[model samples]
Target: MAEWLYEAGIGENRAALVSRGTIWKARIELEGTGARVGAILNARLADRSTGKVTLDGGGEALCDPLPPGVTQGGPLRVRIVREAIPEPGRPKLPKAVPSDALPMPGLTLLERITASDVPVRVCRAHEPDLLEQAGWSEVLDEAVTGEIAFPGGALRLSPTPAMTLFDVDGGGPLEPLAVAAAHAVARAIERHGITGSIGVDFPTLANRAARAAVAEAIDAALPQPFERTTVNGFGFLQIVRRRTRPSLPELLRADPIGAETRAELRRIERLPPPPPATHMTTQRIARRLAQQPGWTTELARRSGGTTQFVSAKE
Candidate 1:
């Protein structure tokens, strides 16, 4: 059996000893630093082989369970490591880079849902005004504009019930664009206070350097409020946000239109017929109409020309 003592910070240091065949108690006092700190003490046998190490007086076992062939009469050694926590009121600088240069990319749609007992109103169109009234317009606008100008991205309504997913698209010129796309997605996630799962799909980058850079950019953009874990080997970034309140999607109670509505919109916009009533055909039409001295004669002259004209009032 061997005995040794170890100490860490100021104040009283605690210790316990265990022998292969028997238990022995040891006392050691740590030097005081007079400041709050943390330390760890470790005790080990001198001999490579010894009996099973057991603590005396019902204390927890200390030494490694498997003895590494300890020899008898070998010198026992004890080591201590100490660490100190900073005092309160310490000023800390921002460790993260500014988000100004790297704009958050993405579009956002807002919907509101009331509690079960609360009265609710259903409107015809997605109301941007209502979202503005709720104080979310600025946040959404900033996120979308940041994403568009900074990177190859666009913000869209997240289809999930209680979560908003900022889908980052790496449009064309794959490698460098993918890296920018990832950074933009990360920035949007942070600025919007989006909670729940955020899934970002980066375009495939053939170059190893480009991939690594994109990964680094992602790490830099995620905020501390959420736990971010990267699957580098698998090429994915997973984020878990600590959420307190319902996200924008949940608050807005907006449901993404189904495939039917999307197809209909495409059909209407690409209609084979002439332009719609609201379509702008000529840049000078408004000015010419405003300055017209004789409206009937001016209209008659324009009608004979090859250019088709539509009256603004009509």
Candidate 2:
């Protein structure tokens, strides 16, 4: 077995731990008070020949040996040491810019959109003056409620000011669905004011004319503020939108998952405290049983017991 030693903190506030070879180290700078504090240390041993031995700050204690089937190794040891160090100066915050001024130019923007089993929208535009002025309130509001419906299903926006990528999925064959999806993509590009490299993956189309039509629809939907947009040979539509401020998504602080959606998700995953089963899970199981009504009764009879059905907890 390998031995490892670790130390942290300084003076009376120090702590140490020793164990098998695996160990972690961290450096922390302290300030002001040098009050008396307690220190802790631990050690352990492990291997095929010897099961495991553990030691704490107080002293070492023998542990029950492993079972015959288990493999053993050599003893493991850990140690920690602490020492006092001088404190450092606090970090300074950047000065705020005036609201009226326009954001600096030559900033890059990126966004990702997803619409498969769930819909998500993300945007990552460089920080800008206009966005700072609005305090990010307006941008957040627009991104969440903005629902774009395709013929197959509708997509709701989920924006972020970090790198964004859009993933497209086929929602089954429906003419209106394809057109609506294309339009939604066009609007998202304009609304986010995304710049730099942009890539979009659309549903695969077997017919060349249908592909051309989708590209044409995207071109027509774009607003005049977007100076130019071209469809490349590989079926990617590129565009440059006029920028006056940071894109709306940049200013907002929101997550991809909302409260209601999170709650629904928990139900779907059947996650909750133990003992109480979730109603959602119970209902799903019940539905399955209903589909094959004889399963429950047959299981109970084979097990030599009466079947007990309990309602699921919410």
Candidate 3:
């Protein structure tokens, strides 16, 4: 039976749906980010001309369809349609629309998984790690490396501001590789929770029937609630899905040092007592770990040993 395994980690909440001894889908919610999607907030209209609103806290949002007769700098009720997306230099502001509905808090990771109607098994620190048993770390590696392997080929995922792209590569006939890539792309899409626009570049096929076959494979593999273009002569296909929150790659790549630190914390916490006093790593990773004392404290509590830090030079 398929079940959702949730772990309230130190800095983030992680969940994975597992069935048949494999992970079908996964999600990670980093705590203390910005207002999540589906949150209703009272914001001040920062600019009527641009329809920008300042959230109660320290974030800004773009509000569409400005409320009628709402003066500039006036209070407005808005619902978050999309969470702020993190990028390299300039991150996108949260998107919202005017709403008169009652205020409501956003759903947490646990709530979202429970809403899926699947049996949820919450994992504790000292319990047998079900998520790791289900290849959770391997999935994280795929997200970090952006390489997903299928039967006959592999897909390289690259997430960009405008769209996420996938390039198929392997040693095989173009037809079978393309077909296999189509299904692999579908599975990866769900596994990573990739949203917004996505592009897949398969081996170019001059044969129209072969392209149709690839498109058919995509249709049969991917789930609904998304729109995709047919495979063209260049073997490029575009897919668009409703994006509310950041995907796995977006979360990890946005702050690589932080991701590495979190992974290290996970490893240290799982070690059978008497973990190393100091973890040696790059300066950036060590600095990031120092910034979050609470996380280190939690790790100490879980591992039965407090952790110190040392840079590679030391």
lDDT of 1 at 249: 33
Find the candidate with the highest lDDT and give its number.
3
Q: Please give the TM-score that candidate 1 achieves against the real structure.
A: 0.33
**Per-residue C-alpha lDDT of model 3 across residues 164-197, encoded as one tens digit per residue:** 9999998869999999999999999999999999
Q: How well is each residue in 169-229 modelled by candidate 1, as lDDT tens digits?
A: 5466766676676666665554344556665555555567767787777777665666655
Which candidate, 1 or 2, has the higher TM-score? Answer: 1
Q: Quote the lDDT for 42 in model 3.
A: 89
Q: Which ten residues in a row have the lowest lDDT in candidate 3?
A: 264-273
Q: Candidate 2 residues 245-272, lDDT tens each?
A: 3233332222223222222222322222
Residue 122 deviation, candidate 2, in Å? Answer: 30
Query: Which has the better TM-score: candidate 1, or candidate 3?
Result: 3
- lDDT, ranked from best to worst: 3, 1, 2
> How much lDDT does each candidate structure score?
0.36, 0.35, 0.89
| lDDT score, candidate 3 | 0.89
TM-score to native of every candidate shown: 0.33, 0.31, 0.95
